[model samples]
Target: MANASARANSVTVENQDVALLKSTTVGRGPISDIAVDGDTVVTTNFGDDSIAVLDSDTLAVHGGVFAGQPTTVAVVGDRAFAAVSSASYDAIAVIDTVSGEVVKEYPLSFNVTAVVTSADGKRVYAGRSGEEGVDVAVLDVTAERVGTIYVAKAADATIDAMCLDTTGRRLYVGVTDSRSSRLITVDVETSRVRRTLEVGAPIRGLALGMEGVAYVLTSDIADGGVLYVVDLVNNKITADVAVAAAPTQLVLSADGTRAYVVDYDHVAVVDTEKRAIVAEVSVGARPSAIALGSDRLYVADYDGGVTVYTVAASTPMLYSQFASALAVPAPRELQPAV
Candidate 1:
């Protein structure tokens, strides 16, 4: 059953090459992000301050939990950490999937723009974008904000997007100030800036793929948008691939060969090696986030709904493999002298 205030609908488009399997309504609010853990697909509802858990196969609602105006969610084992961005009350609601309840609320000093767990489940990295500066708060498993890594020192700067490479040693952060925008890499253990590559525009999205490579999406309404390939080892931008007008989010394929970019009107598949758009599909209305599973691509459309598109099978993604590849030895909390 759909939420009382929400409407539900579904559509399937068939074709010889690719197909749209099922397009269905998800929640009553705008979908902020989509994440898959096991067989369950979870979405954060920015409008209603709630989270929805859906069956990945049927798109059926399993349950919903109140998260206090959440923006992004990260799943670690049995708990989903949702960033609650309300001014009156800012925290991370740790919800247990089995019970569909918020078990914990970790308070934050600033507004959390994004939340992503460490490759290992031992730490949680939350991006706090404030008028003073942008910071990455490192939270322990107990949901306590123990340490903070400053990304930008300027009062007007903001952290736009962030992603971790296969190895947690590198945390790629996108920072934009009045002067310029750049991609900054920070060392996880030392919490020190390693490199900075000026991109000149707000980085809307970032995706880390195989071999220490990153795909950065930058957009300007007047200048259009571009996808930049950054070689982490070299600490430089290697290629710039043109994309749709207003690319919002990006998802890299399991094998890291393809990148799926969602814009206001279409989703473009770009071959990573070739750095070019290989295929284009028109998805009416503005599409937001995307997740791949079950030989299908699931897109969250703010106006349309949760649309499922059938795609040719590729190498299946293993959650454990990602965790292993990006996992780092747990860093201990700094202790004051006794």
Candidate 2:
């Protein structure tokens, strides 16, 4: 059924109100994580033991491969590392984006919940949450497992989210307990916690922007949810953007002016400078993952479907000083690994 809809040729959905570029079904349901590079789109189907791959240029499905219980994914160059953390085992499935096949796997003792890789595809950083203090597993592409980088304390702390900056030199780790949360910056070269910022709520998503500006999404029982704008350069929370009661995911636009957040049944577009929700796109099903690439918004839902949109945000494109960063970069094509 869902695959049948995707099996058919793609059709564009556009209206005066909704700028839907296209929509298609990937697999069964409940996509947990999604990653996009220059030429491909990959989603971890937590609803099943597989990951779906799609062609970025044509929006065509390239099928997928079995990845066990993949909870998170990070794409670098031609390879995509998916964190598989089922009760039976724990590993990272290295996938070839072009062939849609799992080429390799790196086994680990700790369960990886979130993963991100360097630009060169040489190193993979995985976030592990468990009884011990939260730690990041550093794995080499050629050597498998290498070492660990500790980030938070052990008193019931969990790694909620993690993001690598553009330079690939700095990492932002988000750790949360029942009542408190902290954002820790890790220096990748030395593997040390450089700075820590206290957050009032549980961190759900982490995204880095231009000029050391980080958008951290959090959820609170009393305050619902907020998109905390953190000035990493100054080490402070600049603004609190009230998004919704439970925002699950976040992605920033290529222009660095807008941030798209998944708020239950809708995707809220935020103005980074003004620190506000400027627009909300209502989805048919509850959204589980969201990503942006080359001016298109890709949203995965609980119904095993993905809707791509050519979002026309009402907010300003970028900060006046960063006007030259307006050109959107094309998706990276998966090439043969040397």
The lDDT of each candidate is 0.73, 0.76
Task: Pick the lDDT winner.
Answer: 2
lDDT of 2 by residue, 180-230 (tens): 898999987777899999996888988887777888999877887789889
Give TM-scores for every candidate, taking all chains together and pairing residue i with residue i: 0.87, 0.86
Q: How does model 2 score by TM-score?
A: 0.86
List, residue by residue over 1-338, the lDDT tens digit for candidate 1: 32312333223223233566566676675788887766677788786777987777788877778767878887756778888866587887778776778887778777777777775656777888776889887777744435777777877787777887655667788888888899998888788787888989878888887666788898887767899888888888888988878888887777777788887777777777887777776555567778766467778767526766676666644443655655464344532211
For residue 88, give model 1's deviation from the true position in Å.
1.1
Among these predictions, the greatest TM-score belongs to 1
**How far off is model 2, as Cα RMSD?**
6.7
Error of 1 at 41 (Å): 1.1
Q: Count the backbone clashes (under 3 Å) in each candidate.
A: 1, 4
Whole-model lDDT for model 2 versus the true structure? 0.76
lDDT of 1 at 177: 85
